[model samples]
Structures are given as structure tokens and as C-alpha cells.
Target chain A: MSVLPLVALVGNPNAGKSALFNALTGARQKLGNYPGVTVERKAGRLALADGRPVELVDLPGTYSLNAASPDEQVTRDVVMGRQAGERRPDALVIVVDASNLDNHLRFALELIALGLPTIVALNMVDLATRDGLELDAAVLARELGVPVIATVAVRKRGLDHLREELGGLLDSAAPEAKTLPPERDFDAVRGEARRIARAAVVRETPSRRLTAAVDRVALHPVFGLLLLLGLLFVMFQAVYAWSEAPIAMIEGLAEAAATAARDALPDGMLRSFLVDGVINGVGSVVVFLPQILILFFFILMLEATGYMVRAAFLMDGIMAKVGLSGRAFIPLLSSFACAIPGIMATRTIADPKDRLTTILIAPLMTCSARLPVYAVIIGAFIPARDVLPGVGLQGFVLFCLYVAGIIGAMLVALILRMTVTKGASGGFLMEMPKYQWPRPQDILLGLWQRAVIFLKRAGTIIFTSTVILWVLLSYPKPPEGSAVSQVDYSIAGRIAGGLNVILEPIGFNRDISLALIPAMAAREVAVSALATVYSIDAGDDEALLERSLGDRLKDQWPLPTALAFLAWFIFAPQCISTIAVTRRETNGWKWPMFMLGYLFVLAYVAAGLTFWTATALGLS
Target chain B: MRLTELPLRQPAFVDLIDWSVLSPSEGQRLREFGLCEGASVEALHHGGLWGKGPIACKVGRMTIAMRRNHAAAVTVRTGPDAAP
Candidate 1:
């Protein structure tokens, strides 16, 4: 057995580094957190033509080795072999955007000074050529003192040459410490890069007219904001419209699977667990796959097409007014999918205060986890009328719920900025990369990764929680002839009964209170927990048990209570994983505890207000 | 005049970068993006209704957006060769 050599993929942001990594090591990637930090650690395995394997780590994209931001610090640490628990990489694969060599080559020059065995993958060569620039690879190689291979990462061009070069270097001893130009100052390195570029790169004609033409409209103050909002509206609308058929298919499959299990197995604990715990619990979360995938698809597309930066540029004015950098927009937008990644993405925010404020408000963005709770509540309570000619009233309400989260986040950020995190606003210096057509493969890969992550949670955390809830609801035989449901005597029932004292004022019944306990672990689990609890409470009423969870909730709870539940979820301190990630990212229990406290108070007050207002209006 | 005072669409040569107005890291970043002395920059757009938001400037072949406060630190002079 031999240790696989570690090869790190390093490049500037949006330089097609990840794309090249994916091209070289498809489906062999593992994503985790680096040692103690929440910064994402993505590593993959690449095999050479001769079947020898090497580990490839996709380091966080950074502009330079100045170590200004956490992400950049991690990149610097890994390249220098200073990151704890990680050995120095055997080789370095510097992925550079050929179209943007003038700007990218400076970083390339800085990396070369590390005196490591390095190969430059001149990625996006096709785009560079399309832009009418002629790049002499051999000349660049000679000028940089390293092998340069032109690559179109998206199209898989020049990857074989890249693999061959990497393979040949795998067996070579570490390069001896070569005396290189002093790198203490960036000016010297940047000057050297300019010299190298002038000697190697030839320009035929200037390109980027198409990009500039598109930007003219996309960056128009009036039209640009409208276009951005329209794009977001369409994305949310598509999440609802496109996910309908797939959600229905999944629901149908879950029902059929439950039915099959019920008919095949004898009436026993095993059968009950199979249908109620496994099928109903995991099934509820799994149905959300389509919506999550749709959200990520749009996000990944916006990112790949280079429009996200322009969006930040457009929103900077409004965002800055709320005391957040425009760069905060990307992380906050990512929170719409999940807060963990959104919080992690805040590393790009160079200012610590701005990054902290972004993290504090990220959970208010209404992640996809909350979609299940909102979907069930809205489906049952909100009537399916056409608000517009084609839009369902349900989706419109769902959109409003999402908007409420965004507005809440902004308010919180404003409050924090004016008080605790108050300071000079962070600088919003960010590069607006040239626009390109998003590659389908990259989109597919991104969506695939999201789906896998969601399903893995369903299979593990949701699965275990559901089984535990089932046991809690099923155990402890009722006293003989006791005039109550079996669940009334169970442990979970007793706990909910006690909790109802605090919950009743907010229009939550004992059943809703029971669901709230597990909902803390993950918001979507509340729906499954309610379903399992209600099904058991309906014992001996086969038809009632078979009724859809939404129908049952509508029958059991008043409209005011349902509305209150929706309001509760809007501010709920749910999703323990989010809190844990926050703790890790902030490197303290203080912020997470504070987050939990404020969110709880907000949820209680909002739910109470909603319930009382609806009751006062005679809706109850 | 400060880079922030530069008219939109007019190119100027950066004269001096005053590090006093910006934090150390921000000054380093601005320099890394080619906003150092002698670099040619063209103000492309000013954000917000009152033009108090981030200013988008073209540096080399890249366009970067920075707050007006940070842009105020860099003094520039309009030049014929620097015109876009």
C-alpha cells in the first residue's frame, strides 16, 4: 500500500478551478469542514492513465497570499503546509483563466515563488480564444519556469495533458529549494507577472463587447434593479411551479410504499415502524428534494454566469444603507437554501464585523428546511384560488413568507449595525467577472451534490429522530379501561400536555406543541412528527389514519392556530445544526446562545400576535 | 482630486493612495487590485440615487466596486492617455 500523493488545486475566484477539479475527479469528491473552522474542505481523487491515484484538494479560491480573509488564510496555510492535520501537498496545480491572464498571472507569479513543483492549467482557453487572444503556452511555460497546459475545463479539453504532467511529477522527488525573486513585496511579483505576460500573450483584437453590451442594461440603475427582482421572482415561482409534478410523484411513491409495507407485513411493531417511522418521516423530508434542487440550480447558474457579482453591485446601495457590505448579499442569498453554507460563505466578507453581522442574520432568510413546514401549513389553510390568472394563492402566500424572512433579516441587520456591530461599513471591493454561458455539466453537478446532501440528512438525522419519536409515542401501555387514546398515556403525550400550558396562549394545541419539540432538531421534522403523532392518536380509525396530514391538520385545528403556526415558523429558533455551525464559525458559544434566545422571543411574540389578531378579527 | 470625485466615464491616472483613510487590510486589497499609484482607472458607475454608494471603476481589464469612503483615499489626475 502506498499513500496517494496530495495535489492542491489553487486559483483566483471564478477561474474555473472547481470546474477543472470536477473534470479530473468526477463523483470522487468529499466535502467536509477543515479542522476547527467552518471553511469547506473539498478533496477528490484523481487517477492517472496508469491507474495510480492521487488526492486532489480544491482549496478555497483566493486572489493573493496576503491572508486578509479567512478563506484566503486557509489557502495560504494549505499551500505552505501550515494547516494543522494536513501534510504539504505533493504538487500544485495552478488553474488560471486564460481570458483574464493579465489579472490572474500576478497570483500565478506569487505561487511560483513558493518554489514548489507546480503546473499551470491555463483553463478557459476556449473562452480566451473566443475573445480573440492568442496565448503561446510554450512561451508562457518558459517565462514562468513551469509547464503550462491550455485547458477548457468545461469542455474537458487539454485535461489529458494536465493529467500526464501531474502523473509524471507524482514520482519525482520534491523540487530542491530554488533561489527565487524576493516575495516580501507584492510590487516586485506583480512587475514580474507583467513582464511574463508581455512576452507570452499576444492580442489580436479586444473582446468583451458582448459582455459590456449586456452589462449596459444589466447594470442600469433603474432597469438593473427591476431585472434583478424579476429574476428572483421567477426563480421562486419556478421552485413552486416546476417542483409540483416531482413532489406529487414522490408523495405518490411514499404512499404506495407505505401501503405495500402495510399489506405485506403482519400487524406488529415492525410493521408500524416501517410505515409510520421510516416511510412517513423520511418521505416527508425527501419530497422537498425538487424544491431544494430548483433553488440551488438558479443559485449555481447565477454564480456561474457571473451575474451574482453584478447583483451585489446593484444591491450595494440598498445593502450598505442597512450597514452591510454588498458582498454580504451573496452569503445572505445562499441562506435561502441553507444557513450553514451561507454562514460559511461569509468568509469572503473581509471585515470581521460585517461577516459577523451577516452570520447573525443568515438564519432569518428562510432556508429550504422551513419550506416543508410552510408548504404543509399553507396547503391546508390557504385556499387554492388564482391570485393572478395563473398563480395559485398558496404559492403567493409562500412567497410572502419568504419575503417576511428577508425583511426580518434586514431589520435585524439594521438593528445590529446601529448597536452592537456598529463601525465604519466594510469596503465592497469585488471583481465583476466577465459573463459567460453557464455550463450544463456544472449546473447538473451542483444540483446533484445538493440532492445528495439533502437525502443523506433525510436518511440519517430525520430517520433516527422519527424512530425515536415513534417509540416515545407508542410505548407505555394505557391503564385497562382508561377512557383516553393510547398516545394520551405515552411519554411524549405527557410532555406535550405539560407544554400546552405555555403554548395554548399562542393558539398551539397539545398536538402542535408535541411537534415543536422535534422541530427544534430540524424544522421539516415537525411535519413528520405531527403526522406520526396524529396517526397514532387516530388509532382504530383506519380511514382517519389514512387521511392526508394536511387534511387532518385542517380538521383538527382552527384557521387562527394554523396561521399562528405559520408565523411561529417564520421566526422559530429551529434547526440545531444551524446553531452548531454558528457556534463553530464564531468560535464561541456566545453568539449561538444569543441567536437562540432572540429567535425564541421573536417566535413566541410573533405567534402570539398572529393568533390574537386573527382571533380578534373573528377568524378563529 | 480624490478618485471618488472623478467623473463617471472619465479615465484618470492614480496619483497617490492615502492609507490613512482605510484600514490596513483594505489598503492592501485595493493595491492588489491595481489601484496603486500610476495605475490608470476609469470611473464607470456610481451607485445609489444620491450617488453616495459604491463606485464601480475599471482597473486594467477588470471592473471593481468599492465604497465611496475607500475611493476617497486615492488621489488621481485626469490624463489624455488614460481616457477610456
Candidate 2:
């Protein structure tokens, strides 16, 4: 019953549907590829040529109305007017890749058969011409009995003509189902589509097919994998190397702001709230923005070039051996950067069980959030001197922590596939899209959106949690001038006192317990929480005050506690944002709760084991 | 012979398929990839770090990546090009 004349842009996967939608309607919602990179429906407002505003939706790409995956199901449902929460679209713009006409035409034909007001958008006509093929839009329009608009969505060609056609169609009366073609099987429609495509093409010539030439090496057994590996190495290296200056810059600004607030405000809870809770808590997260953006830039760019799919193809064998799908590879790799997007990326996974398994194991990857915890602990305990000639002991242990997460994830995936999420790995089946240089605008747009989301989380989830944590640490102040620490009188401190009883068996002290609770807000928060606790404990002791957080920890914390805590972080679902995203993606409390439950158990056992082993070995 | 057994770059017709053995989604994918009976297919590439892995096949104008297991269920006749 919604009024804005709804127009749904539909097409086969990689048919330039999304690009066209972006061109016609300024982007609104996001998708992952079901959204694999996205599945969510993206809707926007498009003003027709006559200044008539209409609602436009970009549905998930589908091969045909016969939906194969949940993503395709949305397309099918929306188009057929069966999708809940959406009105039947008033008109359909069936987008087809001009170069791959035969395959794309099949889906277009199926949609056209639905008998709604429809037009064919011969998208990517420029690519087709480049590939040495000429498309006759008139012939196509005549044959299909609908307007055929040749569009280069990326370049915004034929968009005005497209909008004109849409305006005219929507201005006219609602078309009845009089044009509904007779029910046909898959082959019948596809064969007819081939005939129509053959008729529409005016010329064809043999050109060097770039995709095939690239695949010769990209899909090669040895070189393709090596290339993929090289690309991944470069991506990780860039994330670490390129992000340092931006992080430091963000940190410096936060410090300056905090200093200004401290100087301007009278010293009290207000100053502490502004300095510690608002500025420092939020600033800690904003600092990681550079890393997140850097990681997403590489993922988005690779995805745009269509190499991401090929990466999955190359990794299928190894991934299959572990009882998971190849599609799981990208998400798992994404987890190393941050588990939030990684879990969101699992929407691309088709199988219910396969997606569930990927979600469950995604957090087990050593996200950058855990890097601070590891860096702090390792700097305090592990020696920087080389264990081997060139391999520093600290770096080696860091490497081992990453390796441990991977091995743990693999074992857990194997076990889950056999138990809770038991199912045959949904065999990886995907269309290898044609390679094209990603437009700079698209890459920038994607990165901008990602940065916005990351910042938004800092504002909402991190903001609320930081305030609550600050409140917990502040209230119930110490009795007047007793030599007692303020934290010892606080509610959070008492909670940690109780938690220490449970964490004690694994070598954790009261301060470690205090830090672990806030660390659940984010893994990196553990470092600051530890620093805060130590500084509070320092309390007028000038020697303790001058020492760095790491140095203080080095003196008081045993090697076993440090080792056990590192082991705990490797498995713990420490980041609230990851759990929140898990809840959103899975659409219920069931999965996120399951994720938290299992991860807590794993963290406990891992810490206990590491504690017992290190203690017994007399490392203490 | 099964589609996996076809020699690389050799155009073949999908002669028969055991739909029962393949999952619903797998069959749907094959259909979407245009690997139906009598469709001309050429095994373009073998993916993964090993020989036994997913197969990249040219089905019509599109290239589809599928696992060896799914490819094994598809029977094909490799000879002169034939329309299904």
C-alpha cells in the first residue's frame, strides 16, 4: 500500500545491476554479495525525467526467478510480489550484461515473462563493444516487445533514456498480466534467450579475451595460489605499514582534546568523565579506524576486480579438506582485520549450516583488536632478543598466537561440522565475473561507507558502554582519606573481586580480573584497563608512577599469568561489536548467545590449560 | 564419461546428469551455469593448489566454478560439438 511508484532493478549476478542502480538512484542501503559481499536490499529515491520521484529498490542478483540461494530468493520474492514488507514493484528494469547476452538474456526473458511493465537495460554495452561485439537495441526491443535501453551503468550512459522510458511506463495505466508467456521449463526459456541474443547481435569478432588470458595464470594450480598469497601478504603488510601515521595522528588529537578539557574544567568527576570516559574510551576506538579502513580498501578493491571469487576458487581444495566451503576463506581472512565485517561477510555463504559454522568460527581468527592485548602482554614478558638468528622471540610468539587461532578455528570448524552445524559443506559454485579495473569512485564510496559504520559504532555501542564502565569505576567513592585505593571501594572493583575467585584457578589476579571485564567491550580495552588499574594502584608511589604500564606489569605479573591471559584472549569473544554484528546477521539471539557460550568455555579451558602447563614447567 | 574425466579444453556435450546425487542448490547452480543436457562445455581450468579440486568450465559465454564432487555427477560426451 506504499505509494511511491516502486521500480525494482533486477538482473543476473554481475550483470551491472548494482552499478546501474547506483547511477539511477543515489546509494542508500548496503549489500554483502547475498549481500555475498551483500544480501540486504538497497532502496533509494529516483526522480524520473518529469521530476516525478519514485521508490527504486536494488534486489539481489538472481539467475532466474527460480531462486537458488537466500539472496536469489529475495529477488524472486520481491519481483513476484511475494516478498513481505514490500509492495509489488510497479515496473521492472531487467539489466543484462551486453557481452554475456546469451546467459544474461535467459534471466531477462524469465523476468519479462512475468508480464509486468518491463524494459531491458542492455548494460555494459561499452564493455561489449570493447570485446568486439555490436548490440542492436532496436532489434532487441522489437523482438521482446519492450523498450531496450543500452546502458553503460558505470559511465551513466543511456540513463536519461532509461529514466524517460520509466517515466512513460509509470505514467500509463497498470499493465495487466495479458503478456504472460506460457509456462516453460528452464531449457526452453534459455534456448529462446539464445535465439533472441543471436538476433540482437549485429556483429562479432575474435578479440583477445582478457578474463581468459588472466585466468591462465590466475587459475593456475601453482602460480594462481602464489599470486593470491602475494596479494594477501601485500594487503596485510599495507594494513600494518600504512596505518601507523594515521593512528598516531588520531592519538595525538585525542590527547590534545583531553588536555584542553582537563585544563578548562575544574578537577572533579566531570573532568574525569570527559577525559577518561568520553575522550579516551572513544579515542581508543577511533585510532583503529586507519587499520579497519586499510583492510576494507584491499578487500573492496579485490572484490571489485572480481579476483575475490577466484581467490575462493583457488582456496577451495584446502578449505574443502577442512569440511568448510571456499566462500568461508574470505570471511575468515576478513576476521583477522575485524570480526564484525567478517561475520557480516558470511551472508554470502549460501548454505544455512555453512554460514552458521563460518559465523561461529570467525571470531577465533586473531583480529587486530587482540593485537593490543598481545602487544602489551608480550612486551611485558616475552624477550625481544632473537630466539633464532633472525626470529625475535616476541615476534615468534606473536606469530604463534596467530597460528594458534587458525589451528583452533580449523579444529572447531571440523568439530562443529560434525556436530552442532553438521552438514555437507555447501560445495562452492560461483560465476567468475569478467575482470575490470574498479572505478576510483566506487572504491572511495565503499571505503567511506565502511569508515562511517566503524565511526557510528564508536558513537553508539562504544559510547554507551564506556559511560557505563566509567560510572561503575567511579561511584561508591573511598571513605575520606583512608590509605585505600578508590577502585578498591568501587562497584566494578567488587565485581572483579568476585570474578577473581573463578579466574584465580587460571593464575589471574584481581587487577587482571578488573581488566578482563572491560576488555569484553573491546579486546584493546584490556590494555588501557590494565594501565588504569596499575596507575590507580601506584597511588602516590613516585617510583611506580614513573614506570610505564608494561614495566609495572613486568614486575608484578608472573610469566604464567601473562601466558594464560594471552591464551584466554585467543579464544574469548571479547569484542561486543563482534557479538552485536553476529546477532544482527543471524537475526536472533540464538546464534550470538551460542557464540558467546562456546567461546567462553573455550577461553576458560584454554587459559586453564596454559596456566597449568606453564606453572608445572616451573616457568613461574 | 563424467565431466571431470573430460580432457581440458575439449568441448563436450552434457550427456546425462544424476540430479538425485547432487544437492538441490548444486543442481540449480548447474542449470544457472547453463550446463544442461546437450550444452557445449569446455573444461577451461582446474583450480586450487592441487590437481583434484574445483573445475572452471566455459558453459555458453559464462565461466562457472564448481567443485570436483559436483562435476563428477555430470556425465558428458566429448567428441564433435553437439547441441543439446
Candidate 3:
């Protein structure tokens, strides 16, 4: 079997490089971290028109070979074949936006100077033509001494021509390696790019006026800020409102499956494991999938429309005041979905101090993993009555929890910036791509990718952990004559009994302490852990196991305890993956350890305060 | 006048950049973003609640937000007769 030729897709940010990669790769893709950094390494399989298979690597977007941020460094390293454990790419596919040829041609020239077999993918030609730009691909190809193929990545137009050209290149001998000239004067490069662009592109009409009109309002100080906040408010509300029916259906399905398993399997350890452990435990966490998807839907739409960059511009002042650049906004906002990606996104922050500070506070930004815990608690305690004519009381509590997390993260960022990571904030110079209506296909693909990742985590890690937790709570057969339940005699119960000494002050009971141990792996697992623990404690009461976990939680735990648990989750460094990512990103245990220590202290103090205050208010 | 002091939406031509006020890399980055001498610039918006924060400027086709101190390093000629 001949080794497949490696093709790298490279371009500047917002060049539709990802759209092209997705169009080419479809479902045949793999995503992982780069050799040492947390920046994602995405590669996919592409079968050419001539029946030749090629490996396509989607390199991180970069403006130049002069790497400033870690993301750009990864791109440069991969292109130079200097990245560890990565082979040199055989061919380079430079995806350039046709509407903005001059802006993109500079980077294309840099890649061309590397002397690789290169193909220029003139992406978004549809948008370019609509904007009254006439681009001659043949002229561009001749000028750059490379094949130029017009492509509309979103519509999959001209992909066949792109593949055919790539196939022809793959069949030929590898191009001789060449290095860029030692002279790094970008002015010359810019001049050459302009010269080439002038010959290849003709602007029939000015493209900036329409975009400028939109920016007049979208970038307005008062109106833009209000619009951004309104968008965010709608997103949070939609996560609850749009997902309610689907969540209830998922919960019903989980309960029905658990009951069916209970009836099909005879009374034994296998039955208990399948019904009580797997279905009840993992099901509780899986039920929150709809909420996670709805949240990502809004995020993906925002990203697709290019408003995310404008958001960073809007928040730049506040972020700068807190000693961070506007670049930190994207990472922190992404943290609302998950901290691991949020931390990885920080690679775009040029300054080491700013990046590190951003990573430290990322976990406090209300990740989707916390949604299950929050949903269950809010569903149980917070009444269903509307705070206003339209907003439910439960959703309002959830929004408050999210706001609390953001506040906690901002305060921590300020402290870290002022102290350990102290340094002048870096530049906030970033491209604000023109807005376009989000393509349904692109948004669907993004949502699908997020759903797969979440379900995979639920099926594997959550499934395995739940089984292990079941054993810890189910075994060591209580003395046949003993009045105490089997859970009381189990190893997990013993451990929780000991840990309760510390947890008790925070209003965490023995069962809650038991859940906390497994919750360390993933925050959402706490809900499932509690479900399994309570189901086991119910002892032969199958009906209790089938009941809604929220109802069970409300009956078992007091108001103060539930509120304290929510408080702890807001600040707790519960996700082990986040900690692991922190270690990898910082390249040491020092920062991760410090993060864990501070978060632990914060979680404890906050939970204790909440518990005490609620008790004082007679909420208990 | 400093680019920071330029009126919003008024076009200006950059005359000089006080590179000494900024770190070498930062100055290089600013130039990379097309804020070099002879580049046309317009202050698009001022950020923050009091509108005295980072200034969003159009340097060529790119929209960039820079701190006041950073913007202060670049001198821009704002007269109607200033060269394009």
C-alpha cells in the first residue's frame, strides 16, 4: 500500500479555510491536539477524482510565517515541516477569499515563496461576484505560478476541479524544497501582492459601503453593546426554552429503558448493573444533550455570521481595563461551552501572560458539563412560575448561575493579571470579516460535530465511571442480618463517610460527598452519580430508581444544601480534562496545581457562605 | 496630532510612528497591521462606557482597536489638504 500524499490547507483567518476543509473531507476527519500545544490539529481523508487517496491537514490560520501567537506558530511549524511528529506536507492548498484578494494575496505569496506544489483555492467566488468583483483565475494562476481553482466551499462548487488539480500534482514528483529569502521586509511582499492582485482582480463596484453601513450600527458604542447583550440573553433563554420538550422526551426514554431492563433481566448483579448503574447513571447526564446542542447552535450561528470578532471589538475596552487584550473575549466566551476548548482558544492571544491568565479563569465560565447539575437542581428547587410574563423562574435561576460564573471568572482574571501574570496588555488588532447569512449546512455540521463529541464522552467515560461507581456502592454484601443498607457497607460509603467531615461544613452530606468524588472526572457526572447513589440507597424500590432524579434530589436534600452545591459547582475545578489541558498548555504542573488549589478554596468558601446565608434566611 | 486625538470618521495620513514608545515587536505588529507611515487612517469609534477607551480605527481595509497609549505613538496629519 503506497503512503497517501499529505496535503495541507493553509490560509489567513476567516478565509473560509475551514469551510473548504469540511467540504472536502465531509465525515472522514480526525481531530486531536498538536504535538505539545493545546491548539487543535484537524486532519481528514480526501479521495481525489482519479481514485487517489490523500490526507488533508487543516492547519491553523496564520497571517505570516513570523509566528507571534501559538496558533500561528503551529501553522508555521507544520508548513516548515518543523513540527514534531508531523511529516512535511506534499502539497499546499491555499484557500483565499476572492472578494478580498489583496488582503489574502500577501499570505499566499508567503506560502508560494516556500516553493511547494501549491494550489490556490479561490473560495467564496460566489460572494465575490455578488459583491461586483471580477477575478480571473487563469491570470492569478499565471501570476503566482500555481494552479488557481475557483471554489464556493459552502455550496461545494468547483471542488471537483480542485480535486482534479490536486490529483495531478500528487502524481508528479515532489517539488524541491526552497526557503524564503533572509530579507523579512514585509513592504516588498505587500508591494508584490498588490502588483499581482491588480493584474488579476477588477473591482466593478466598491465592496466596503454595504459592510460599512452595517458596522455603523453593529460597531456603534451604545447600540452594538445592547445588541450583543440582547443576543446573549436570547441565547441563554433559548437553551432552556427550546430544549425543554426534547429534554423531557430524553428523560422519558431513559426512564422507560431503565424500567424495561429491570423487567427483562432477572434479579441479580447483572440486572442491577444494567438498569441501576448504566441506564439510570449515564442517562441522567445524557438527558442534558438538548440543552448543550441549543447553546452550541447559537454560538455556531454567531461565529458563522462573523459577529464574534465584532463582539471582541465591543468588549475590548472592558477586557483591556482588566489587563487583557480583546483577544481574550473569544476564549472566555468559548469557555461557556467547555473550558478545554476555551483554554485551547487562548493560543491566539499573542502575549504569554494574557494567555495564561485567560486559561486560569476559563473553567469558571459555566461549561455545558455543569448544565446537567444546574438543570436538575433548578428544576427541583426553583418553582416553575414565571418571573416575568414570559421568563420561567427556573431559567432565570440558570441565567443567574451563568452570570455568577462570568463574574467569578472576571474577578479572578483581574487578580491574576494584577499579580502573577502581570504585564502590559497586548495588541487587539484583528480582522473583522464582513457579515453574511450563516449557511444551514455549515451550522448543521458544527452542531453535529459538537453533538458527537458530547455523546462520545457520555458513552465512554461516563459509562465506565458509572459502572465503577456502582461497584463501589453495591458490593461488600452487608452482613446478612444487618439492618444497614448494602450501600452503607460499601467502600464508597466508607470513603464518603470520612470525606463528609470536611464537606459537612459546606452542607454536603455523605451521599453528596460520594457524588463529588466521581464529579471530579466531569461536572455533569455529579448528577448521574447522585442518581445512582440514591437509587442504590432506595434498596429494592425500583419505582424510586425510575422516578425523576430531580424529584428524588428535592426530597433527599434540603434547600440550603442544594443551593450550596450549586455555589460549589460555580467555582470548583471539577473537570479533570480541564486540569490536564492546563498542565499541557502551561507545559508544567505549577499553574495547574495553583489553579486547583485556588479553585478548591474558592469553591469551599463560596459554598459555605451560600449555605450559611440561606440557613440564616430560613430557606432550610 | 496623535492618531488617538484624531476626530472620529475624519480621514488622516500617518506621518510618523514613535516606535520607541512601543516594544519592538509591538511596533512591528502595528506596522504589519498597515499602520505604518504614509498609511491612511480614520478613527472609527472610541470604546468604554465613557467613550475614552481603546480607539477603533480603520488602517487601510482593516479595523483595529488599540489602547490610547498605543495609538498616541502614531502621528497623523488631519487637515483637509493632507495627502492621501
**Model 2 misplaced regions, further than 4 Å:** A1-3, A27-39, A50-52, A177-182, A334-350, A367-401, A423-425, A519-563, A574-594, A608-620, B81-84
Model 1 chain A, poorest ten-residue lDDT window?
A176-185
Runs of candidate 1 with Cα error greater than 4 angstroms are A177-182, B81-84
DockQ of each: 0.67, 0.78, 0.52
Candidate 1, residues A124-219: lDDT per residue as tens digits? 988778777888999999989899999988888998888899888777887863333344677876777767877877765866566667877888
What C-alpha lDDT do the candidate models reach, one value each? 0.86, 0.81, 0.86
lDDT of 3 by residue, A453-558 (tens): 9999999888888989999999888987998887778999999999999999889998889988899888888988988998888768757755677888888899
Cα misplacement distance, residue A583 of candidate 3 (Å) = 0.7
How many pairs collide in each candidate, listed in order?
0, 15, 0
**lDDT for each residue of candidate 2 in A1-620, tens digit (9 for 90 to 100):** 55888999999889988778878876555543332223566788899898988888888887877675567777887788777777789999999999998888888888887889998999989888888999899999998889999998888899999999999998889777533345788888888888999999899996988988999999999999899867865665565567779877987898788668867998777877776677766776677788778778988888888898898889888878778888898898888878976887787778888889999999999887777677668768987687777546766677678779988998998898899888667878888889988767777877888788768867876677677767777778888987767787788889999999999999999888987887787777776666556544554465764565578888998999999999999998647778777877788889899989989999999999999999999996
Q: Which sequence of candidate numbers ranks them by lDDT, best first? A: 3, 1, 2
- TM-score of the A chain in candidate 2? 0.87
TM values, all candidates: 0.96, 0.88, 0.96
Q: After superposition, how far is residue A597 of candidate 3 from its true place, in Å?
A: 0.9
